[model samples]
Target: MLDAGLLVPTAATGLYQRSGDFEDAVRAVEAWAGSLRLDAYPRRSLPPILPRADFLQTDYLRSFPDLAGIVSVFTGGDAEHRALLEDLDAGGNGSTVLEPAETVLSSAVCHSVYPTLDPAIPDEGLRLEASGFAFRHEPSLDPVRMQSFRMLEHVCVGTPAQAEAHRDVWLPRMAEGLGSLGLDVRIEAANDPFFGRVGRMLAANQQQASLKHELVVDIHDEKPTAIGSTNYHEDHFSVLFDLTTPDGNLAHSGCAAFGLERIALALLSRHGLEPGHWPTEVRRELG
Candidate 1:
């Protein structure tokens, strides 16, 4: 992709400036995914940064602290600023002068959605289609493992049955959608990269309960990459966000998230770098 000018690299690993062609491919993939169910769900557009208070509520720090990207800024006075500059000039890390900002880079697009929902959901439940940028602290040379990426997600909040059904329905649908794009796709049980030993137990329980499933495609010769995922949070967000069903039970949440850049890369890898030259059916589907 770098050789083809589809991706422009920066000094930061896992971060790249996408080309027009790359963005076009991303939009095409997003459009294709949206066409699958956009009309049924209300749409939401959220910022990439989340309120620190809400971030704390999500408990991401407990589960994936290693991947969290906290936004820190210089909130110092003039004297402090001068000292910070002098420190930097003296080869000292200026970050030492920075303080945590009110917001943190969102780890997932869906994290911001939960806070927006009502404390009590209706019987039919709530469903939304949201698209936004997401961030993680992991830095890697692998293009597929981008530290910053765009996500398009369909989120459902309701009873456990509703959440499970939402995940179940979308998992295969996403796999088929990607397969239609001429890429070999598979649906498999997966778990989040939780932190530490306790997290290992959480991950094991998550897998045991089949709470997460991923739509994976081969973008590399070595292994398959997950371009999309379906996750069921059984009252996890509800307990934190204080959400409940109309009947008073805690609400369950499920989401299917599509990694736009990863899907675009998969398409480029499978059907050649040129989108125009991709199979006619694939082009038509993307359009």
Candidate 2:
């Protein structure tokens, strides 16, 4: 049974305060990432705001408009502010003075890499590891479904075969790592939450191609939840960003992304609330 305030609720519905044990588990996961042979250089805290135009180019609006956290601010000048303040005193025009910002809150860390890449990549391709906060407008009280969350992301850009192979290598490796830590883990093909009727068709096609695979673990319920994912976006971002291989073919891109908060929650669920009493192997590896 879940305690009343284990995840201390904040003003936001989907964001919650994490306990100290949860923080330690997140640190352990980061250490595990360092053990991988991905040759990924670490970058921390990607820019919070993304260019609205850049986001639009990625077709995010078409797929996840409902989940986007668009940045809007008060554009009112001094006079407008006073009027708005007066209206606020009157309780009417609080929203009227706000205008959309040039940037939207970032949803994923992977999109940040595309803008920094060269027009063409070398035969060897590129790999990067980054951790950052991302925002989605999901309004759930479940600790696993945070509106603001962190992702430890590993991205690869190369030929189609190379990209897919990268995902294949990491998928099982991650599962094994998590399993050793005492979590029930498995890999399965998956699809994103797309929008509308056309999006349902796109999701089916995506599953048919087996482009996305998730490392799922039993978190809070009978049905398992995905703690990490390996995604292969075959030339989709490449074409959009003009990324190409040495041979001039559009580069294929893939990523392995770990949800830090979700993993921490899983650890607490598996190992009991107290970290000191956890299994010896689990404590040793994390220590």
TM-score of each: 0.97, 0.92
Candidate 1 overall Cα lDDT vs. reference?
0.91
Off by over 4 Å in 1: none
Candidate 1 per-residue C-alpha lDDT over 117-187 given as tens digits, one digit per residue, 9 for 90 to 100: 88889898889898989999899998999999999999999988988889888988898888899989888
Clash pairs for candidate 1: none
**lDDT score at residue 161, model 2, on the 0-100 scale:** 87
The best candidate in terms of lDDT: 1
